[model samples]
Target: MIQRKIPSAEEAEKLKALGLAVINKEAEAVAALAGRINGNFAQACCHMLACEGRIVVTGMGKSGHIGGKIAATLASTGSPAFFVHPGEANHGDLGMITGKDVVLAMSNSGETAELLTILPIIKRLGVPLIALTGNPASNLAREADVHIDISVAHEACPLNLAPTSSTTATLAMGDALAVALLEARGFTELDFARSHPGGSLGRRLLLHISDIMHTGSEVPVVREQAQLRDALIEMTNKGLGMTAVVDARGRLTGIYTDGDLRRTLDREIDIHGCRVRDVMHTGCKTATPDMLAAQALQIMQENKINALLIVDRQQRLTGAINMHDLLRAGVV
Candidate 1:
């Protein structure tokens, strides 16, 4: 094992101070970007919005890394975008770009050799070129149809040689573009969920009660005229810690739960002789099959319940779900 040496008090304080300095410098760089979101930024957005095809993002070095993330953000937020390495674009990767696409090039110096090498080809394709660069006066920016200035006063690096504050500023600029486009397109949470179905937010927004609930024979249920013992057996067999009490027409009249059992025991009631209707609680909270699992979770939490009945609009029990079911479904 490679053990790390613990820093001394003075060293630790110095390390913390250095970290804080980096954060403050990067924050200031990002804050400065607000001023850069002017006519040129709007022009860039307009071009991207009008594009019928994808946003082809190309960059070199650290800017390339930032461009990849920007592409992903744009792709997930209603704008179709993908990252293409500038160096690779010079090889055979230029074929990936189409005449219908918009090219977004990132270069801190506005003169990355690899990116500049492909500028003529991009122009030949007759695509709108949006350049994000620190040097607005440089060649790439001058050639671009719209130039976004991501310039930072200073880098967070002590030597001012590494890409730190500049990268942070660039990333912030990318996020600003993506969010503006999202709002302009009227993108909703459902749209975001559809794009990210494998994530937690997608699980919360897209999972429905009908998708996870115990249905038909799996639902713990009993007739209103059934004995309390029968309801208990149903609850035990279904393992939902509760049972639905229904009428002869199969419409839910009430619910019988462990809490009700406790109350019946407190009253010294005869469990074998008592009817389910005599002890069940009426108007128990119920959910529709189309209700979001996230909504079901909220209802259970607010009512301090561990299970819920799924019913049709006519109050007929269709399914049931317990806290465990929600937990298993990753909605909890």
Candidate 2:
């Protein structure tokens, strides 16, 4: 069901220019928000922070899409929030709104019938309403305890009928509110990670070296005094591209990696006769059990090495971590 119409060089250039103009228009609309961040904006943040319950976001059509995204950002950052379609509120969703909850209504014209219809239901509960709209004199904005000016000079659409610039302005205002509340609540990166547990962000913040490191029998370890052949056998058996070389007391001495073995091969050394201590890298990189996996990655990157060892305060070898393990754990 797809058809292709290839454009000539000039036609393609014109299309690119048109896209850039739309971006520039929207960017200008967002930039103008600096002047509109007035006292009412601060009041809006205070209202949400003081709420004992959640922030209920309601909007219609294109405004509803932006509201959904705003609600998600607020929930993940720190504030409790969710989007309720304005059209659904009158049916049965009105039961979800309570006195403790605060309502954030979005409408470019500030005259959405579906949203206005729910005003009485919210009013009976005495819930505070904050409006993000273009017209301050409109009913939704007038009824709101705090009115945010999301007015835009024009839409990005060539015909000026679409909701491009206004939606962008509303989204920016929502982000500003979320960030202000996040700072007020002193929400940390760890809190954000807990809310977003399924993504790479969660892996980077919560994962520790102990969580993904190869431990116990999986550790490729050999004594420094052991023959280089023994070290090579351990490395080959474990297949970590490296082996930790320790002393008899299990204290780390050095590391023997594929790179180290390659350098020794040029000398035509006897693997069986040479001690691991003779060729092992004494100044190799190591990580601790308590360090974040991301921090371990930094060490490997900064030192320009793939394999890292974990040791205690006494330098006893406890675990081994390689770039591959980090990749598998989604920490890389």
The candidate scoring highest on TM-score is: 1
* TM-score of every candidate: 0.97, 0.92
lDDT of 2 by residue, 1-332 (tens): 89899999999999999999999999999999999899999999989999999999999999999999999999999999999998888899988888899999999999999999989889889999999999999999999999999999999999999999999999999999999999999999899999998999899999999999999999999987889999999999999999999989999989999999999999899878999999999978898999999999999999899989999999999999999999999988
> Which consecutive 10 residues in model 2 have the weakest lDDT in total?
90-99
Error of 2 at 193 (Å): 1.8
Give per-residue lDDT, candidate 2, residue 224: 77
| Global lDDT of each candidate | 0.95, 0.94
Q: In model 1, which regions exceed 4 Å deviation?
A: 1-3
Model 1: how far residue 202 lies from native, Å: 1.0
Winning model by lDDT: 1
lDDT of 1 by residue, 249-312 (tens): 8898999999999999999999999999999999999999999999999999999999999999
Residue 216 of model 1 has an lDDT of 80
Q: Show how many residue pairs clash in every candidate, following the order shown.
A: 0, 0
For model 1, what is the error of residue 217's alpha carbon versus the real structure, in angstroms, after optimal superposition? 1.9
